[model samples]
Target: MKKEQQEKSFTMSGEKRSKVYEEEAAYLRNRRSVAGTHTTDRSGIAFSGGGIRSACFSLGILNWLERSGMWKEFDYVSSVSGGGYAVASVLEREFDGEGSGKTRAEMVVDKLRHDDGYLRSKSATLFLLVISASISGLLTFSPIMLLCGQSASLMINIYPRTVDNWASGIFCAASAVISLSTWRMPGMVGKLTLFIAVFFGSIQVAWVTGYLPPNLRVGMGILLILSWLIVLGLLGLGLSHPLIKRIQRASFLGLMANIVLTFAIVLHLVIDGTGKTHTNDVLACLYIVSLGLIFLALLASPNRLNPFLVTYYKSLQTAFGNGRDDAIWRNRAQQGDPIHLINCFVQSPRTREEPVRSRGGENFCISRFFCGSQSLDYFRTATWSSGREKKPVWRHQTIWRLITTSGAAVDVHPTRQSPIVNGLPTMFNIGLCSWVINPSFKRKHRKGGPVFVLNFAAAVGGNSIKQKWIRLSDGGHFENLGLYELVARQCMDIIVVDAGCDPEYRFSDLALAMEKCRDDFGAEIDIPGLFPQRSPGRCHQSKFEGYIRYRGVDKPAKLTYLKLVVTEHHSMRMRLQSSIDPKFPHEPTRNQFSTKAFVDAYYQLGCETAALAFPVTGTVKRAA
Candidate 1:
C-alpha cells in the first residue's frame, strides 16, 4: 500500500511541473507580443464612406471574409461617415447564430434594405438635408430682390431699357455678393450656399448704393453701418469665454471677412459712381494712395489669426520651445515664448551676408552674434542670442483678450514678457511650414488634443487677411477619410475597401488618400499604373475593379485597395428589395440601392469582391 501511494504522489508532482512550464511559456509569449519584439502578424481592414452602396459592399465583403475564414484574422475595422452605418450595424447586431437565423453581415444588409430601417439612420438623411438646406439658405433673398428690382417690367408704359437696367443690376449684385461671400465660407458646401445668398443680397445693396440719389445713398449707408455695428457688437459679446473660444473664433473670422469685403464693395460703388476718381490723374493717384493707406491700416489693426492657422502656429511654437532639443538650447528656448522664438528664427540670419548652415541634421541656424567656439558644436548649435546673460521666460503676446488662444496660458516671463518683447514688429512666417514632434505620447482627445502643426495647405485664414479663424470639416472632405487614422494607429497591413460612390469612376480620391500617407505620414506607397477618369460604361467593367496592392516600405504600411463595380442586374435587384411601404417611412430613393433587392445584390457583390481579393490559398500577404 505504501509503495502504491508513493508512485501516485510522484506522478502528481510531475503533472504540477508540466503546468508551471506551460504557464511560463505563455508569459514569455505574451511579453514578446506586448513589447513588439517579434514581427507583428496582425491585419486591419477599413471601410470608406459611400452612401448606401458602401454599406452594402462592406457588409457583403465581411460576409464573404467570414465564409473564407479571413474575417476573424482582422484585428481592427474602422470607418467614417456613411461607412459608420455598416460598422455600427455589425457591432450592434446579435450574432448568436440562433437568433434571426441570419449572419451578422446578412442582417446588416437587410436592415439597409428595409425602408424604415435605413431611413431611420440619421447619417443616411443628413447628406440630403445639408444639400437642400444649403441651396435654400443661399437663395432665400434672391426672388424678392429680383421682383423689387424689376417692378418697372410689369408697367405697360415703362421703357424697354428698364429690362436692361434690371438685368444689369442683378448681374452686378450677384458679382459683388460672390466676391464678398467667397472669402468667408471655407467648406465646399458652405461656399456654395454663400454664393447663392450673396447673389441676391448683393443685388439689393447695389441698387440702393448705385442707382439711388446721394441723399438716399447716405441714409442707406447709415442704416447698413448701424446694422453692421449691432451685429458685430452681438458677436463680440461674451467672446471672452474659454469654452466657446473655438466657436467664437470661427464665427468672428467669417464675419470679419464679410465686413471687409462689404466695405470694399460699398467704397468702390461710392467712389466710381459719385465721380470721386473722375477728376484727373491727380484724383486717381490720391484714390490709389488712399486705398493703400486703408490696406496698411487694416493690416496694422489688431485681429485674431484665422483660428486654423492659430492652432497650427501654436503647435509649431510649442514644438520648438519644448525641451526636445539639446539641454542648453532646450532650456533657453523653453524660457522664451514660442512665437518670439519663431520671430527670432526668421530674423536669425539678419542680413544676406550672414551664413546659415546646420550644426548637424538638427533644425538650427547660425546666430548673428558670435559666441565663439561654445556655439559651434552640435550640442549647442549657433542660435539667436539676447544681449542679456540669463534668458528670460516669455509669455505669448495676446492682441485680443476677448478670446482664449490655442495653447494653454503659461507663466509670464518677467525678463522678456514686457512691453519691449510685445512691441516688436511681427512677421508672418510661412517658410517653416513643417510639423514638429509632440512630446506627450497620449491619445489626441485626452489632455486637450494632440499638439502638432498641421499642413499649411489646409489653412483657411491667417494674419494680413480678413478671415480670423475659419472652420474645418471632417477628413472625408479631403478624400483620405479614415485611412490616416488607421495609419497613425500603426496597422501592419491595411486593407482599404474603396467604397466611395464615384459616378465618374475617377481615382482622385484614391490619389489624395495616398498623398496623405506619403507626404503627411511619410508612407512609401506607390501606384503601379494610373486609373482612367471615366468608367468603361458597363457596370460590370473590369478596368478598375478588383484588388491592387500598394507596396509600403518602413513606417508607411502596405495597403490593398479593393475597388467594387456595380452591374445593371445588381442595381435593379437592390432597388426592388423592400420591407415597408414607400410612403410609410419615406424610404431613401436617391441612392443606387433604394430597395431590399438592390441592397441584397450589393451585399452579394461585396462578398464576391472579398472572395476575389482575399483567396483561401494563404498565399496573399495576410496582415498577420
Candidate 2:
C-alpha cells in the first residue's frame, strides 16, 4: 500500500514539471516578438526625432548667421578668411562658462557659436573658393587652344588625334605647381589675381584660336578640376595640429576652392558640351553632386559618402557625357563646332556699351545693363557664315523628318529613319526659332503706352503709339551684334504674338496654366507672362516684370490664354490680357508646366508664327 501511494505522488510531480516547462517556453517566445516590435518602433521614432531636432536647430542658427552681416566681409577677406565669425561670436561666451552647459539642442546651438572652429574652417574655405575659381578660369581655355593650334597646322586636320596630348603629365605638373605656389603667396587676393590672370587670360587665348573641337577637348578640362580636388584632399589629411592655423587655413581653402571649382567645372562642362556640341542630354546637378564631389575631404564625420565611391560615380557621369546618343556624334560631324553664347549687356534703350568683338575683331561697345565685373561676362564671336550650307545627308527618323522643312535639304539615310541635314541632324538646321516685335500693343492708350518707334518701314505696318516714334528694322533692336548671328544661325522668323487685343478675350504674356487656391481665384486666373510682344529676337524682355509659373497638376485651376500683369492700381481693375488665340494645342496641363514643358512650349510656339509672320507685307508708318 505504501509503495503504490509513493508511485502516484511521483506521477503527479512529473505532470506538474512538464506543464511548468511548457508554460516557460511559451512566455519566452512571446517576449521575443513583443520586444522586437517595440525595438523597431523606438528606432524609427529616434531617427525621426533626431532629424526634426537637427533641422530646427540648423534653421535657428542659420537665421542668426545670415543676419549677422558676415557675408559682407567677403570683400575684405585675404587668403585667411574668417568665415566662422558668426559661429564663433555666439559660442565665445558659452565656452567660457558664463552660460549654462545646455541641453542637446542648446549644445548644438553653442557648438555653432564656437568662433575658433568657424574662423579656422571659414578662413580655409575662402582661400579654396578663390583658388578653385582661378583654376577653372585657366582651365576653360587650355585644351581648346592646344587643339586649335593642332587643328590649324599639319596640312591634314590632326587635332583629334593629338587630343591625347591634352591631359599629359606636363599639364598636371604645371597645375600642381600653380596650386602649391599660390598658397605661399603673401595675400589671398594676390594669389587669386595670379591664378585668375593665368586662367582667365588663357580662356581668351583659346577663344581667339577658335579652332579646337570642344567635345574631345573636355577630357583635359575635367582633369584640371580634379587636380585641385586632389591637392585639397592632401592638404586636409596633412594639416590638423592645434597651432597650425595656417595649415587649417590652407586645407579649408583647398576644400572651399574645390567646391567652387567643382561647380564651375560642372557648369562649364554642361555649357561647353551643349553650346559647341548641341548635346544637353546630361542631367544638371548643381548642388548634391557638387557637394559630394568636393566636400568628401572635409566631411569630418563617420557617416559620410566614401571618397572612392564618389570618385567612381563622377567618372561614371563623365563616361555618360561622352556617351550621348549616336545622333550627337552625327550632328557634330555637320555643325563643325559649337556657337559660343557670349553674354552681352546693353542699355535699357537697347545699345551695347561693351560690344561682343570677334577673335580678331577687338573693341566692343560697352553696355551698362551688364552688372558685376564686365570681365565675368562671356560672349561669342559670330562666325560670318553666308547663311548657306551644303545639304546634310544622314539617317533620320520618320517622326523627325515630318517636323522640319527649313533645311537647305534633308535626306533620309540608308540606315535609320531619322532625317539628316548637311550630314547632321535636320532638327537643328531647319528648326523654327521665330522672333516678334512687341505683341502687347493696345489701340486706345497713348500717354503711358509702351514704347513704339515712329516711321518704321517694316513690311508689317507698325501699330504705332500716338506719342512714341521708333521704327523696327527687321524686328531688331540692334543692341547686340551677337543677336544678328543667333538669328541667322537659328533661322528664326518674326512671330506676331499679338497684332491687336480683344477686350473680351484679353491676353497677358503670363501663362496662368496652374495656380494655388483654385476655388477662390479660378475664374480670375491668367498666365503671368514671361514674354511680351518682344520685337523679333528679343529674349525674355518682359520676364523681369513678373513671371508666374505653374504645372499641369493644378488642372482644377481655371486659366485663360491671357497674360495679366497689373501695371496701374485701380479698383476692380481687370488686368486680363490675352496671348494669340489657340494659345496651345489644347489647354495647358501638368504635362506642360515644368521647365522641360516650357522649353517644349517655346519650340511649339516657334512653329506657329512661321506661317503668320514669315509672309512679307509692304512697309508702313508707326500708327498714332
Candidate 3:
C-alpha cells in the first residue's frame, strides 16, 4: 500500500515532462516578444556566486550593460548566491518603477554606501542567534535533567537493594557504552552490540523497578520490554527493507515512548522523595549540568530561524525602502523583464540511481513561474507555499526568501548519509545560515510542536529522508557559476559574469561548470583563452570568448565570459591599493563592511574591464 502511494505521487509521465519543457519554452518566447527582444535564438546572462564581492561587482557590470542598452537583449538572467543579491535589487527596482530618477545600480550603491557598517550588523545578528539558541536549550532541558537525576538517585538508594540490582546497573551502563561506541561499525558487530545493549537495558529496567509495588513493578517492566522490542523491530525493518524508510520515524516514536515512560518513573520517585540526601542532591546537580551540555550540543541545528538578517533582508530594505512589502513575484510575472532563475541546490539523500553529476544533491531552481528540480519535477510557484494539505499557510515561497535561499553561503554540510567534514562549525551553531524549506510535492507537517523541547527534539532527533523537508544552502556548494541551468535550458548565447574569488585565476568554478554541463547535458563548452600563465606581478587578461555545442542542436551557441579582475589600470584601484589593502579586487569575501571607496573601486574596475573587453565600437573579438 505504501509503495503504491509513493508510485502514485511520483507518476510523472514522459508526455508530462515534455509538456512542462514546452510550456516553459513558450513562456520564454512570449516574454521575449513582449519585451521586444525576440530573436531566432535564446540568450542568457549568468552571475557566479561569491557573497558580497560578487554582488557589488555584478552591480557594476549591470550598470554598464544597462547604459549600453545591452541588458534588455537577454531573455534570461540566471544568478546564484551573492549574484542573486544584485539581481534581486535590479528586479526590485524594475518591478516598482520607483528609483527616484536614479538608475537601479546607482540607487543600490547609494543605499549600500549609507549603510556601510555591514560587518557590525552581521555580527549582531549572529550573536542574537547564538544567545537565543542557548537560552532555549537551557529552559527546555533543565526540568527533564532534574527529573532523571532524581529518579536515578531513588533507584540507587532503593530500600533492601540486593547485589543483583547493583550488578544489573553496572551491566546496563557497560552495555550502553558498547552500544554507542559500536553503532557505526559495519556487518554483524553493530547489530550484535545493539541487541546486547537492549537486552541488558531492559533487564536493568525490570530489576531496578523491583522495589515498586508488586503490580506496578510487573506492569512497568512489561511495558519497558515491549517498547524496546518494538523499537528494535522497527529498526530491523528499516535496515533490511529498502522501501520502508518511513518506518524509521516509527522507531524514533518508540524510543520517545520509552523516554516518556522513564520520565513518568522519574516523576513518581521525585514526588515520593524517600531517597533524599546531600550526595543525591550533588549527583542530581551534576546530571543536570551534563544534560545541559548535551542540549547545548544539539542546539547546533538552526532550523528555527533564518540567517539572512543582514545579508539579504537588510539589502532589500536598503534597495526598496520596504523589504517585505514589495510584490516581487507578482511584478515580475506582469512585466516584460527577463525570466529570473534563482539557482539553488537541494540537499537530498544520495540514491544508487542518482547521476554522478548530481554530486550529492540535485539542482533546485526557483523562478517566478515554477519551482523544483529534475528529480522532483516542477510545480506552480503560486501554489508551492500551500502546505502539503493544500491549506493556506504563512507563505514562505517569496522571491526575496528564494533569493536569500540561493545565497545561503555559510555553515553548509553534506547530506545526512555522508561523513561530515569540519563538523565543529555545525556543532557550534554556525550551521544556522543554511535554509530549510518544504519539499515541492512531499511537504510534511513541521515536525514537533510549538514547545521548544519538542522542536529541539525534532531538529536534532532523526536523520531520515522520510521527513520530506528540503535543505537548501549555497549554490556554490554544487556549482558556483550558475551556468548549469542556462545550459540545461539550451540557450543559444550566454554571457557569464565570473565574480567568484579566484586570486590565483585557476578558474576551478568555471571548470566545474563546464564539466557538469558536458556530462549532464552533453553540452561542450570550449574557451581557448580560459587558461593563461599565472603571474603575481601583473594582472591577467580577464575576458574570454567561447562557443558551446549541445547534444542534439545543429548550431553551436556563442559564449562570452567576463571575470572580475583588475585588467586595466584605474585611479580608484591605485588609490585603494595605496591607502587600503593591496589586494583590492582579490580581497577576502569576509570584508563585507568595506567603505564607500572600496565599493566605488570595484564598481569602477568592473565598468573599465567590461569597456576594455567590449568597447563602444565592438572591435575586440577575443581576450587581449
lDDT top scorer? 3
The parts of candidate 3 lying over 4 Å away from their true place are 1-19, 95-101, 117-119, 122-127, 136-312, 319-322, 325-334, 349-358, 386-391, 415-422, 432-435, 442-466, 569-579, 617-624
lDDT for predicted candidate 1 compared with the true structure = 0.38
lDDT of 3: 0.62
lDDT of model 1 at position 191: 46
Backbone clash count, each prediction separately? 15, 68, 0
What TM-score does each of the candidates earn? Answer: 0.39, 0.16, 0.71
lDDT of 3 by residue, 325-421 (tens): 4333464544556788888876654343356222546677777667677766676665454333545443345666666667766644343322222
Q: Which regions of candidate 2 fall more than 4 Å away from where they truly are?
A: 1-103, 116-128, 154-624
**75-125 in candidate 2: lDDT tens per residue?**
110000011111112222122244432322233333433321111224554
lDDT of each: 0.38, 0.24, 0.62
Q: How accurate locally is residue 598 in candidate 2, as Cα lDDT from 0 to 100?
A: 27
For candidate 1, lDDT tens digit of each residue in 75-124? 45555434544554454444545644455666655545554224232453
